[model samples]
Target: MNFPDLQTERLILNQLNEQDTSALFAIFSDKKVIQYYDIDAYQTESQAQQLIEFFNKRYLENLGIRWAIRLKENGQLIGTCGFNSLNEKMKHAGIGYELAANQWGYGYASEAISKIIELAFSSVSPFCELYRIQGDTMIGNEASEAVLKKLGFKEEGVRRSSGFWKGEFHDLKCFGLIKPEFKAL
Candidate 1:
């Protein structure tokens, strides 16, 4: 079955394609945007092109879903969202995304993530008994922390020096939004 394109008040979430490379590069080349991200900023247009192809292959394998975050008003790609780390663990499938720095506070991330969370637990598969959305965010990313909280994630704790980035070990906030606790979100 095909997943219908998802729309929020100001954004659309859909799969990525070659046509989006330019726009992907536009946001990904900004070093600060990926500062807390695991993937590095694209060094050139070709890197972005390669990333677009990689995204396509992942979908072809049914191994993951990556949706381009587009501005509904202009149909422009501002970011990407969806699940990563799908496996038997059930603990790893998660909602992950990044947006153009300019679009940071407009509710786009939460809107798109909320949809993915709904789909993951309902339309995707084996939703019954699934209890939570486990997530991790770098210690200082207040923006991401806030979004997760808005989505009803509770911070259980933090892992000290769990990630090495920018030449230093960083703490990562651990969070979870379980099914029973998610009703109000």
Candidate 2:
């Protein structure tokens, strides 16, 4: 399916156009933001250029989808959020989001993810199996964990040494919401 322009009550979830690359870089550039990410440079304009190229490639490939989050009243780029990982065999995708540190404590993350849950589990036909939504949070990211919980994702398990960040091992919290369980939300 083509990338979509999804809307939530307070945000317009539009596909990342040219104007969003720098804002994307801005979020990644913050060390505080990048600290929990699996692979992030925080930011460098050069890396932003590379990221823009990468997003274009993946979007064309239908392997990923991304949206630039903007306030409905103004189009300022607050952050980019969307699917970043996929597994065809598993018939599931990992949903992710990153926001400017300054934008925290608002309902944006939860609001954005609510739409993703619906999209993931939307079956095209009676014969189509549903897509499951999964997320992994580095064990220390309490804020992320809270967001996932508020969004109705279940804590499936914890992988000991689940992820390696900055060459050091850290447990990663695994989360998921299957199609059957989502409607209850």
Candidate 3:
């Protein structure tokens, strides 16, 4: 499937490219931006390059897609978001997203997520069809939880020591939204 660019009133979601490497690194390497994320703050632009490549490869393989979020007015990259791993046969996929610290509390994350949810649930291709969208964040990440709740996801439970990253285990709170729930939103 080809990657599709999405737009909202204040933001645009497009494929990550070399031009975005620096801005992408800036967000990922910031302490506040990745505070609750499992991975360590990126230490080099090479990591961002690898990440861009990874995102594109995921799309080429029909596994998932990640869109770089930018402001509509100034065209500045603000964050990244999209479905992570996808299970086409099961009609489910995991959602992941992050934004720059300076861009917090402005509803950009929620807006971008809502748009992606609508597209994901509405797309009907064999590979793009998704019945359920799941988001798992570090336990105690209230900001992420709020975003999920605002978008109509229901908290299922916390998986104890579910995520192993950066040499330690972390609890993950799971949130899920089905097609019907998204439609109601």
- Best candidate (score: lDDT): 3
Model 2 per-residue lDDT tens digits across residues 1-185: 55667788889887676666678788788887777887766446767767767865776776766677888878777877767766667777777888888989998888988876676677641112446878899978999999999988899999999777788999988998887788887
For candidate 3, write residues 80-160 as lDDT tens digits: 999898998998999999999999999999999998888888755335689999999898789999999999999999999
lDDT at 48, model 2: 71
Better of 1 and 3 by lDDT: 3
lDDT of 1 by residue, 150-176 (tens): 889899999999988667888899988
TM-scores, one per candidate: 0.87, 0.89, 0.96
Between the candidate structures 1 and 3, which one is better when assessed by TM-score? 3
List the RMSD of every prediction in angstroms: 2.5, 2.5, 1.2
What lDDT does model 1 reach? 0.78
- Cα lDDT for residue 141, model 2? 93
Model 3 steric clash pairs: none
**Which candidate number has the best TM-score?**
3
Query: Which regions of candidate 3 fall more than 4 Å away from where they truly are?
Result: 123-127
Off by over 4 Å in 1: 1-4, 88-92, 123-130
